[model samples]
Target: MDLAFTPEQQEFRAEVRSWMEAHVPKAPLKTLEGREGFDEHVAWERELASGNWGMVTWPEAYGGRGLDLIRWLIFEEEYWRAGAPLRANQNGIFLLGPTIMEYGTDEQKAKFLTPMAKGELIWAQAWSEPNAGSDMAAIRSRAVRDGDDYVISGQKTWSSRAAFADWCFGLFRTDPDSKRHKGLSFILLPLDAPGVTIRPIRQLHGETGFAEIFFDEVRVPVANRIAGEGEGWSVAMATAGFERGLMLRSPARFQAVAQRLVALYRQHADTASPDTRAAVLQAWMDAEAYALNTYHVASQVIAGAHIGAEASLNKIFWSELDRSAHRAAMSLLGATAELRTLPGGKGGGEENAWLEGYIFSLSGPIYAGSNEIQRNIIAERLLGLPR
Candidate 1:
């Protein structure tokens, strides 16, 4: 794949850099896991939308610049380099928005896309259930038809952003007799709907970035369904591809972390062990490799190529890379890594960003169709191994 950028692309990058340098918040916003932080992040999203940069890959009609995947990558790089606030509505803008654009009715698009871009509505994902974390087909959440409405009743766990999200997109078994991947329907529901309950789950870092949601005969309009009945599995798999391949974990994020890791090592290099230094270097190399691979994948996607099992490979690579980078950071910090609070407010009062990141990285292998499932896909599909 060609690595060179055209003059236009270079100019675009310059424009993005200038905009970010000028407008990114000087102080980092609080984490979006709490109510105060969530509102702060929502404001940031609106600010980004006002500049038409909330979702660059979206169509111009939807408050975007109608940019290509390559430009999106450039935007992400600049965004991270500027240390912008983490997106509060990432589930809406990244995973669900694309699926909606590809499957939603024109009316649905008009109703949802604009508000989502403006951060007027934050979205959470509700896919995993008590018994169906990785084995999604085992989902027991049921949505029974009732005239023009579907009554949903079941429970979903580990829902990211659910604690304060306005809406949710998830899979429900519409056909009670159906098993596995069959008889499923993709649907969107309001979080405040009657009979719905949300309970926050505190992470190891004492943050509630995830939650459990319970639905008890919650009623939603039939119009909220995506694609068609019994097609939820196929639609969700496509979203999963987007999650594992490009959007959910961007290469720019890792590259920025790698740069920080290197800087951290340099600060303590004189006293650092050889293995720690080696790990730091390896992290940087792996981050660069991921970025390059992403460029090739984006090129093919823009050329109308479909990503298959390679998404699994990409997921595995980046998740492990993230964990390894954070682990190296912890090692560099040594005993201080465990300190609830670092001197000079380095760890955000009770915990530092590195320690917080390390905690979050532990979940990387488990989410978005866990690393084990991705490896199985790689072996069975990509490598032609038996299941």
Candidate 2:
């Protein structure tokens, strides 16, 4: 409960800050399709990998700095403050890497972990389908065992990073007759397999960062299964817990964005009403609260305590705050904001980063278990409420 960082922790923060100031790109990361900006983001990730700061808390064997979780938080703060590229393979490295560390075989670790840590092998999450999204237990994608391989056939929509990823980790119904949560299995498949097809989905913001994937008898090696058949629901749930919680709701990233939003507001205060000033002040307070919550969670994680539903609360707060802050920014920019995409770019700012962020924020309330479901978890499991 002591909130202060130790002397060693403070020193670690200074070290990370110094490293990032030297390496972070001079300009903001470019959205994909931008000439040098996209490449620059990739280069920034590689630069972090080169510094052994890619996955701060992973074991050294997996290409990490071998630091503890507190130090990892410091690294994240510094990375965001320096305006480093967003972790493009976060679905692979943040959510799946930890799952594999706990559940995967040594061979699986040797194959996926190092490459993921080094940013050499980017991955996508192929979980949502035309029918099964928030209700992951309803997944109908099937993978039937065929000697040394499994033939997978189904469609996955909202498959982020599939347009550029080399692999995907997802759930499949290996026991179709077993019903609901009992029939599923977790599996990894190469995206370039002959029978696999990927088509990009253009967002409201004009970005094609997400896609739909079709598996037409796509064959994957039996070695790709993460957990045993019938254990996929638990594996997927566990993964979602991380996705919607501490790892995905990194306070440092949110705080940096919130800071930028504040700066953007100040740059155009003439357009903001007194009510808008109140909204911005509230947002700043919420951002600070989120930072404090994350720091507490980091301390608990570093002390080897298991994170629980409280992480869900953190996700809920930060995601909504992100939306609120961005909306405020767009509102302040007024008519000029309509000039989106850096003046020469097409569409409004709403269609660029803020719009994309707002759309993505909408998904936050739905994914990793909907906010209503998260409330159920908090009420029943955390608060001991009646079913």
For each of the candidates, the C-alpha root-mean-square deviation to the true structure, in angstroms, is: 1.3, 2.6
lDDT of 2: 0.80
Show pairs that collide, candidate 1.
340-350, 347-351, 347-352
Pull out the clashing pairs in model 2: none
- The lDDT values for all models are 0.91, 0.80
Instruction: Looking at model 2, report the run of 10 residues with the lowest lDDT sum.
Output: 347-356
Predicted model with the maximum lDDT: 1
Q: How many backbone clashes does candidate 2 have?
A: 0
Note the clash tally of each candidate.
3, 0
Error of 1 at 109 (Å): 1.1
Q: For every model shown, what is its TM-score relative to the native structure?
A: 0.97, 0.92
Error of 1 at 71 (Å): 0.7
lDDT of 2 by residue, 120-232 (tens): 88788989899987676788989998998999999998887777778999999998687778889999999999899999888655667779999999999999999787788
What's the lDDT for residue 382 in model 1?
89
